[model samples]
Target: MSLVLGCNISTFDSTTAPADLFNAVRDQAIAAEEAGFDVVTIGDHLYATPGAPDEPTLEAYTTLAALASCTNSIQLSTMVTSNTFRNPAVLAKMVTSLDVISGSRAVLGIGAGWFEPEHDGYGLEFDAVSERMAKFEEALRIIVPMLRGERPTMDGRWYRVHEAINEPRVRDDLPVMVGGGGERRTFAYAARYADHLNITCLPAQLPDKLRALEERCAEAGRDPRTLEVSFATPMVINEDGEKARQQVEEILVQSGVDASMASEVFFVGTPAEVTEQLRAKVLAHGVHRLMVNLFAAGQDLDVIALTGRTLAPLVSGG
Candidate 1:
């Protein structure tokens, strides 16, 4: 039950190339591995935001493949990949290959997407919210069976598959982590399909979310604690709590999210203070895995390494 420290390599610069992004991720992965992080992750986005379209958007699988070849130990995967981007069967097969390439050190974190503009730009259907969730449910059914080395057919309103087979089963059953916090559908999906679960943007609701997950597990006839719970917090860590808060504020200003709201959601402080907060969060909510998102605000790789060196072992029981 050790804590995992991973980062999302989602850079917003249109001039960036896929190879360039992969190189940056590879360097971060190696640094994290050397610094004793348990995992490294990336996010998937097709179209850039309104003001951020020039953002470098690399395909998740390609970047992961490059990462697998460059790093030896840190388990790597997406923070959560959009379920609508590719056919579930294809995505499952790609993940299986990634697992093999990485010697079974891969996790698949999938999600029902949220960006309507990205969907419209890519010509993927921007279905109603309920329809999207339904598609996600069917996607899981199609993927899990194939990953288990079972060819299964599924017929759903959004996707149809017949005798889908994902060959070269991963070295082990690679862990599947689904992401979201909607209690009714999300927790239920985690109980039914995910080995790991990630949710963000609701630190205050974590305790309630865990309780809901427990209930869902019970209803699904699954052991409640069998699923691993992970949380991702947008964070800024400096030597001083006030300075860290200031840095987070600057990032907020850049992102137009109101600098005054920094302390409300993000964990910003010195390593000691952040560690205390992290421990409190973990103990209170039973979060076994934690990923600190440090995508922007000019964070150097060394800062993340220092985080692993100074903070991870302390909270993860090392």
Candidate 2:
């Protein structure tokens, strides 16, 4: 993967009327695509995360399907779908359907489920971490083969698929993205199976995480260069540099992070300043691909367009 920039629409404005939520999201996706983003993604959660419990959260696949209808070029995916939420075979079919609908622009971004509260609330079994990783590994065994147009039959400890079939796939080469920070299991899985790895960690932690991933790829007898790695972070940017910094500081304080460490957690400032910050803090560490959630942009079209036009160049080698 060449340097890619993705926009993760992780939150919706709480004040928007319930009936108009999808439209609001659609507009944002259009803006992102028009502004040169390579991919547009949303979180796969039954409830809102990284926000209040009562906030409206759309189902990931459904929202991506809706986005595919309106956006022409940008790829559609979940920031990371939880493997615990659906049967692996079914999840593979959903991705294949999205690929067909979007003219072959769907990416399967998945991870071992982590939110216990959602699982508990939905009465889904929240297994131990070891069990979850085991299930995730088994899921890949089933999902990958099906996505490649082969019927997969597997009777594993956590999942069973009997030659499950998938049809109407636009392409068998749809990318598979695994997102997580676990150095042992997650990194190993990404190296072994994933085409892309979105490492979820603070910016400063990336160098060490990249090294660990390299080690994992070596252990798996796979070349690390074959796997694309990316980092995702919250970004706050504006034409007004001081105002953006102030907003970032407030968020840092609310999250109980030191205000002084804002740059390590967020890309904040004017677009030019943010570009420089990203180069120093992210690209310099060998993480060329980046996904950002522009929480501050909200439904503001101008802000979204401005940020995209500014940051897209970083990935395009401008």
Candidate 3:
């Protein structure tokens, strides 16, 4: 795969009225599609996490379904649906439904559930990390086969499925993407079941994560090249490069991210500067796939267009 760029719409402007929220999201998706983005993903959460707890949040699949109606060709998915949020069989069927609705442009991006507050607020069980990974593994066992058109029947500790039949699937070869940074369980799961692995880590940690993923792929007797690797980072771009840098600082402070670690986690500057930073810090390290959340742009159409226009060429040569 070449350098595939995606936009992750993880935040919503709190100022937007409830009735106009979906329209705002739809516009952003359209902007992304027109700007040359290959995919537009939404975060799955009952409530916002990286932002204010009371911020307006949309359910990932529901929003994607709506976007499918308004947008033409851009792929739709969750940044990652929490495995804890839905039953594995049901989630599999949902993605299949999305695929049909989107003209075969749905990708299943999922992860072991995180964000404790959301779980607590919703009365869902938030287990320890190891326990969550255990459940995640079982979920994948059921999910992967179903996506491939198999009727998987497994009685696992956390989930049980009895020849779950998914109907109306647009294609059996729908891509499954696993997002996380754990080299042990996450990478192993990705190697075993996922077509794409979205590694969430700082720039400096990417090399080690990729190496671990390679090792896991080898252990699974799969070619590492078959698994597309991607890195997602918070991005802020402006014509005024200094202003963009200032926005980055403000975001880091607001998010309580340590100032010393800003460069490792953020891509902020003019379009050219951000592109160069991505080239040196991400693409050069062998991760060709990139997903960026435009934290500073919000629902701004022009900024999103500018970003897509500038970054889309990164993959053109390939």
Residue 223 lDDT (model 1)? 94
Question: Candidate 1 regions off by >4 Å?
Answer: 1-3, 12-19, 48-51, 297-299
Pull out the clashing pairs in model 2: none
RMSD of model 2 against the true structure: 1.7
Per-candidate TM-score against the hidden true structure: 0.92, 0.95, 0.97
Model 1 Cα lDDT, one tens digit per residue, 256-296: 88777876778778888777777776545667567767655
Candidate 3's TM-score reads 0.97
Query: If both were scored by TM-score, which would come out higher, candidate 2 or candidate 3?
Result: 3
Worst 10 residues of 3 by lDDT: 1-10
lDDT values for all models: 0.76, 0.87, 0.88
RMSD of 1: 2.3
lDDT of 1 at 154: 73
TM-score of 2: 0.95
